[model samples]
Target chain A: MAMQERALRTRKSLIHAAAAVFAEEGYVPSSLGTISKRAGVSNGALHFHFENKRALAQAVEDEAADAVRGLVRRADRTGASALQALVDTTCGLVDSLLDDIVVRAGFQLSAERALGPEARLLRTWHEWVEQALLGAEAEGQLAPGVSPDDTAAAIVAVTVGLEVLAGVDPQWLAERRIAGFWELLLPGIATEQVLASALPEAHEGRRSEAEEA
Target chain B: MAMQERALRTRKSLIHAAAAVFAEEGYVPSSLGTISKRAGVSNGALHFHFENKRALAQAVEDEAADAVRGLVRRADRTGASALQALVDTTCGLVDSLLDDIVVRAGFQLSAERALGPEARLLRTWHEWVEQALLGAEAEGQLAPGVSPDDTAAAIVAVTVGLEVLAGVDPQWLAERRIAGFWELLLPGIATEQVLASALPEAHEGRRSEAEEA
Candidate 1:
């Protein structure tokens, strides 16, 4: 392999190792040495890719942010209803949270004490939720009497709540559970017309671009 | 003060100190020595009521459980709508989690890695939600098609998630935020009759037993 290719591979390995360690041990207890050992890379190589653990954690957060952006973009492009897009985005989100170690570590590290101001991932996620729901409201997709702001609060709370619950029980991360939230919430928020034609079931996580396209 | 009164006072002080330390520093890192120092009690006094750190944590948990039971008991006896009782109980719960150090520590400790299966406090809280919502369903206070089980799940997630958010920003625990949650949800869950008369606002936290009575 080319020298650049090998270097990139080594960097990926270190991040994977760092994410697993952070997810399990949190920020204070985890060590660079353990992350290096897990990555099967030399300590020097780990240091070469990242200056310190905080930097490594930041990289994880950036990656998670990118992953979320991808999910939202997919939802935006779909000719699906604005409400279904929101639902699909959450489905994709829970899938990433369940399947993506970097995303998990991004969140876990963001909450750690050692990296005190790094919780921007949640803030960013919240911003996306607000914007998307507002857009949906303007398009007249919302039910009568439901304010976009209040609906935003409910959606953000439940999503964050599910994330916290997932920490204790993986069962909380199931797609059906996410579906249950929308199933309960949509009736109160969406118009009858939207419900009849555009309401999606609480199944299917984020669909890939090619398939949906 | 009488000797017995003074002794009881000292015990109360010690538990308060332990809860503050545990809430800030968590289970493993907080020292009994610091708790004693904070309590302004001698080491002997600290040892008299609680044998060790774990014991001290257990005491906090027990006290928190008692406090929750008190809230629910008052709600249950008021001859109010079962749905209102659930709302008020959560209002009271958020108030305690915000203002009561022991309650906050009890929840924090329940989620600690060192405690193993000692997360009974959360399970107990979940049970109460399930039963209360179920009772409301039986009384026909619930709107048509709103399942008690799914509603219970949303309530637990939002409560736990808000508690976690409160750790970072006290704003999350504001009475309005909690009220906002219920206001958004009550419409979907409560019957029209209940909505006309019993719809909860984002106005009050847990009311005192005297006030509610």
Candidate 2:
């Protein structure tokens, strides 16, 4: 049991180190030597857990995928309008990306052709956004003229775009800019009555509480 | 003049070759050997035109900047509503990216951290959007409730987002999807009377006429 615990801890540390390197330098230029060195683990220990850079990247992507899945699950328990849940979830995601190298590297790796499209993580995120909008439209939470499909496309585009921009200028993912996106888009997607509840700022407390938790 | 023309042609070919490789392999991994081979030029010729990869990349950026500057100049000549010109320019840009590798490489290179913040092509484009929207607001062409600043932010976000998505999926930049974005957004910005003109398809003929010109 003690042996297993030590191995698991080593694996987690290696992943953290790999995510940081991949996020900054990308896949082709990243090396096992640097990753192992960064993790403060021996090269032999690194090989014991992962054989190659591809496998290491895959491990990082898998963790980020789990993080995204967790966001969707959390949204399921929100007990609010689907639209509100989506707003909260997207805002939550941007905030998470601000601090989480694993999640950010997962996205960066997915964009890389070297990974060979094995992850499909971005598409998975889009599908989740689509489902959220569909649920809102079914619940009659959407404004009369809004098309759920169109709204989903734009939302996915904006969020992904913000992620890309954040790669260079983190200011793109600021609380005000993200909240302002919802402010500009909410009036077109949600009825006036629900607009206040659906505002991104309305969910600010949720983020803070999560941070505290 | 004949020898000078040959040098200019060789220079243009090298830039094109470099852009294609950069777009495919990114900064660190791309090589002058591949670029020269792709351009069907000799190593000596490549070296004559560019001292190194960084120099070659700077040339690519210079061409892209010219393209962007041309877009701004064309906008000045549009002789139409500022909002409409903004829409047309963005859609035009998407088309340009599809056909022009230098422009495509320009954006990809700008995203690269090695390039630092020197390119700022995206910032220039965003400023242009802000100006267009500001002009529309000044002319009372903006819809009653729409704030120009917020609207410009959303538009910039969406366009940048679409560009990112297009990197992985070219289908994201299709005419129908681009048109759909305008269709969904026009109602919120342009008054009912001007709605028809703001739709992306409304400018399809305009694009083709220019293509023919």
Candidate 3:
């Protein structure tokens, strides 16, 4: 058991190191030597853990996929409205894309190649989101004409898009900017009444909480 | 004047060739030798026009920026209502992003680094769109309570995001998918009346056009 734990920890350390290097220098330029050096592991140890750089990259992507799925699952468990859950979960993702290097690398790397595990993870997230949108529509949380499939895809696109832009322009990742993003997005998916009531309530709550703290 | 014209054509050829190479091989991996070879020019001739690879990249980015600006300017000159112009202009950008390799390269390169000229170009585009949004709002063409700056930024973010995703997933870039994107986006910016009339017309037009042609 102890040996397994040690292996897991070593594997995680390598992934973290690899994600950072990949995000900084990109896939091709980021070398295995640099990743190993950053992980504070010998080259032989790095090789023992992963077969190649592509494997290490896949591991990083897999870890990211799991983290994202875990977040959605936690949101699901909360029994919140589907729209609310999606907004909260998406906001969490945006925060990570702005602040978390590993998550950013996972997204960037996944796009550059056809990594199967990573692709499956992303597709699963999309499916989960599609299910959530269907629920939101059935609940009448969505607007009259909004298609569940399109809205789900748009929400995913907008969330991913905002993150991509944020990754490039840090200033645009501010809390206010994220709030603006939600404002633009939620209206499309939400009924007019929900937009008039729930969105303002959520925004105001965050503002007041920030002030009180 | 004749010599200047010859130089202009050579410079244009170099920019086109360089953009293709950069898109395929990326920045560091794409060498000056490859660019010159593609352009059918000698290394000395390539250097005569561009001081280095960075300079060549800047030239390519400049060409792309100009293309984007030109597209927007053409949209603005359409003599449509401010809101109509905004929507049409955005749609034009979406088309260019889908079809134009130079624009794609510019966007990719800009996100990867904080190049000065590239930053300026993007900022200029952003400001232009913001100004247009402000005008639309003042003219009562925009939906009530929509902040021009936020909406403008969201538009930029969404468009850039869609383009990036399309790069990764061509399957998602299908006409039907893009139409879905417009459906989600147009409602937020359009007035209720405009949404009722304009969106359906535009959507059907694009759909039939995509289908028949």
Predicted complexes: DockQ each: 0.30, 0.29, 0.36
Q: Candidate 1 chain B — worst ten consecutive residues by lDDT sum?
A: B202-211
Question: Residue by residue across A1-213, what tens digits does model 2's lDDT show?
Answer: 999999999999999999999888878998999999999999999999998999999899889889988987887797867887898888878887788899888877876645674437778888889999999888877766566777788887777777777877898777666676775566456655665453446434433443465
Model 3 off-target regions past 4 Å? A1-3, A114-122, A192-213, B1-6, B114-118, B171-179, B193-213
Once model 2 is optimally superposed onto the true structure by TM-score, how far is the C-alpha of residue B72 displaced, in angstroms? 2.6
Candidate 3 local lDDT, A11-76, one digit each (tens): 889999999999878887789999999999999989999999989988888887887887788888
In order, what fnat does every candidate score? Answer: 0.34, 0.35, 0.43
lDDT of 3: 0.73
Q: Which window of ten consecutive residues has the lowest lDDT sum in model 3 chain A?
A: A201-210
lDDT of 3 at A81: 83
Provide the lowest-lDDT 10-residue window in model 2 chain B: B202-211
Local distance difference test, each candidate = 0.77, 0.77, 0.73
The alpha-carbon lDDT assigned to residue A194 of candidate 3 equals 74
TM-score of every model versus the real structure: 0.88, 0.88, 0.86
How well is each residue in B76-175 modelled by candidate 1, as lDDT tens digits? 8988778889999998999999999998888777655345553777778888999999999999898766668788888888887777667667777787
Q: What TM-score does structure 2 among the candidates reach?
A: 0.88
